[model samples]
Target: MPHLLPDTGPQRTLAASNFTYTVGSGLFLTAGVLYFTQAVHLPAAQVGLGLGIAGFFSLAVGIAVGRLADTRGARGVYATTLVIQALATACFIGADSFWPFVLAVCTATAAKAAGLAARSPLIRHYGGDRPQEFRGYLRAVTNVGISLGALLAGWIVQVGTLTAYQLLIIGNAIAFAASAAILVLLPPVEPEPAVDSPRWIALRDRPYLVLTVLDGVMAIQFKVLTVAIPLWIVEATTAPPWLISGTMLLNTVLVIALQVRAGRNVDSPVAGAGAYRRSGMAFLLSCALVSLSAGTPAWAAGTLLLTAVLIHTIGELWHSAAGFEVSFGLAPKHATGQYLGVFGLGAGLAEALGPALLISACITWGRPGWYVVGALFAVTGLAAPLAVRWAQRRQQAGKGHTASRQPPRRICQTSPP
Candidate 1:
C-alpha cells in the first residue's frame, strides 16, 4: 500500500500543505463542473468565449498578484486571494443571468490564479532546495482532492438537479476559506525583490521567455484533452458519459500513486534531462493515439477513446511532474512569483486558444483535425530534448559565472522553512 504521509520535514507542515492543496483543488474542480453545466445551456462558441475571457482576466491579474507575493510575502497574498475566491464562489451561486455568470467566472478565475501564484512560491519556500520532491508530493495531494471533487460532483449530478451545482459552488467557497485559515497558521517568509523587476522587464530575459514559450506549446494538449476530448467522445462515439469521468479518475489515481516516485526519479542528475525529453515525447504519442479516434469504427470507438484517455493520462503525469520541477528550479529566489506568473501565462493562453483551435481544425480538416493536433504535439515533443540541453548548458554557465564572482554574503541556511 502507498503511504499517505510524506516522509520529509515536520508532519504538521506536510499536513498543512496537503490540506491547502486539497482545498484549492476542490475549488477548481467544482468551478469547472459548474462552468460546463452553465455552458451546456448556451451556444457552443459561447463556451469557448466565456472560458477565453476568464483566462485573459486570470492572466492579467495573476501577474500582478505574483509580483505582490514576491515582494509582500506569500502568506498574506495567499490568504487575501483565498478570501476573494470564496466570495467569487458565493457569487457563482447567486449568478442566474449570462452576464452574472460571466462576471462570476472572471472573478473566480482571477482569484484562483492569484491564489495559485502565491501558494506555489510558498511551497518552494517551505521545501527549500528539495522543491522538486515537495512539488511532486503537492501535485499528488492536490490531484487526490481534485479527484474527490470530480467524483462527488458526478454523484451529485446523478442523484440531484442543477441545484447540486450550487451546492458545489458553496462547497468551493468553504474550501477556499479553510485554506485561508490554514495559511494563516504558517509563519511568514518574505522574499526579496529583484532590481528593476517590472513585469514587462522580466519578460526580456531570454531563458524565461523560452521556457514560457515551450510551456505554451505544451498547453495546447491540456486544453484539448480537458475540453474537446469529452465533447468528441459524446458526439462521435457510443462511449458512456462516465468514460470521461473514469479517465479523470485514472489520472488522479496515477498521480497520487506514483508522483513521489516519479519526482525522485526525474530529479536524478542522470535521468532528469531524459525525463524532460520523455515528457514531450509521451505527450506527442498520446495526441497521436487520440487522433486515431478519427479512424475507429463506431462499435470500437468507445474502447479507442478509453485507450486514448489512458495514454493521455500517462502523458499528463510525466509532463506535469517535470513541468513543476523545472519551473521551480529555473526561477531565481528573489523572482519566484514573477517567473512563475510568466510561466502561468502559457497555461492562460492555452485555455484561451485550445477550444478555438480545435473548432477551427475540425472545420478545416473534418475528422483529420485530430491528426493536426497530433502533428503539433509531435513537433513540440521533438523539440523537448533540444530545450533540455539548452537549459542544462545555460544553468552550467550561470553556475560558473556565479562561482567566479564570489559576493560577500551571510551564512545561509536554506530549507523550505
Candidate 2:
C-alpha cells in the first residue's frame, strides 16, 4: 500500500525536519535535569523547581507565537524558533548558578513553545488533504529518530565524564541548527490573509477550551511511564530495575509500529472521539494492572508490570490519533494557527505539571492513586465526544448565520409579449 504522504516533496521535507529536530531534543531531554544537578552541582530541589516553573510559564507564550505564525508564515516562525532554540539549548553549558540556569531553561522552553505553535499549522497546510494521518507518520518517524538519539546519549553517559555530557549538549544544539537549515531550504509557506481584526479567537471559543482542558487531563497518562513507572517499580512493585528500560523500549517499539495504523481510521471528529474513548479504556486497564502489581510475588509483579506497559502503549497510540483530529477538526479554518496554539496549551500543561500530579497520586497516595488517575482519564475521554459535538454545532451555526446575512441574488423577470 502507498504511504500517506509518499512521493510528496514538501511532506517528506516536513518529516525529515521533524526527525532531525526530535533527535536533537531526545539527546538533551533524556538527561536535562540530571546534567543540571549532577554536572553543574546545583541543588536538586532548585533545578527541579526552576525547570518546573520555566515549563509552566512557557505555556502562555504559545498563543503569542501562534499569532505570529498566523501573520508571519509558519515557515519563517518555525525557522526562527529553531535558531532561538539552538542557541538556548547550547547556553545550558554556561549556567553555573540557579539564575543563569533558570534563564537558559526558560529561553529554551519559550522557543520550544513557539516551535510547536508553528509546526502543526505548517503540517496542516502542507498535508494538503489528510492532515491527521500526515501527523501520525511524522510521530512515528520522530519516535524512531528520538530512539536513535537516546541510544547515542545513553552510550555517551556510559563514558561517565563531564566532557561527554558537554558533547551531548553541543551535539543537540548543532542538530537544531541543522534542522533550521533544512526548513530554510524548503519553499516558503505564505501566511494566511487577515480575516477581520487579528485577535485571539481561540480564547473566545468555549467548547474548544473545554475540550483542550480535557486533553490536558488525559495527557497525564504519558507521565505515568516517564515519571511514575520507574518510581512505582522500585517502591511498590517487585519488578526488577532493568524492567524499567524494557518498558520504555516496549513503548517506543509499539508507537513506531502502530501509530500510523491507529490513526488510519480517524477521518472525522466523531471517529476521533471514539479513539479517545478507546484510549481511556486502555488507560483504565493499564492502571488496574499496575495497581495489582503491589504486594504480588516477584514473578507475578513482573508479569503485571509488563502487561501494564503493553496496555499503556496501546492507549498512547489511540490518544495520539485522536489528539490530532480533535485539534484540527475543532479549529476554525481561518485561524488554525491560533487554535492549534491554544490546543498546544493542554500538552504544555501536561508536561509542566504532570510529574508533580503523578508523584502525589502514585507516591503519596499509593496504588489508589493509579485508580484515581485512571478514573480521571476515563471521565475525560467520555466527555470528549460531547465536547466535539458541541464545538461542531457552533461551527455549523456560524456558517448558517453567514449565509443568512448574505443578500439574495435577483432572478431575471420575463417580459410579457
- TM-score between model 2 and native: 0.96
In candidate 2, clashing pairs total 0
Residue-by-residue lDDT tens digits, candidate 2, 180-238 = 98987678878876765338889988999998998988998889998899999999877
Clash count list over all predictions: 4, 0
**Which predicted model would earn the best TM-score?**
2
Model 1 TM-score? 0.83
**What TM-score would every model get versus the actual structure?**
0.83, 0.96
Tens digits of per-residue lDDT for model 1, 1-417: 236455545334645555654655664555554445552355545555666688898986776788789888887887898888778868866665567777887888898888777776777777756877877776777777666666676665665566666666667678777877776567787677555434554465566667677767776776665677777767765667777766666666777888777777676432544554666666666655666665467547766776777777666666666677677776767777777887788777877777689767743456677766767766665665566667667768877876777877889888995
Q: Best candidate, lDDT-wise?
A: 2
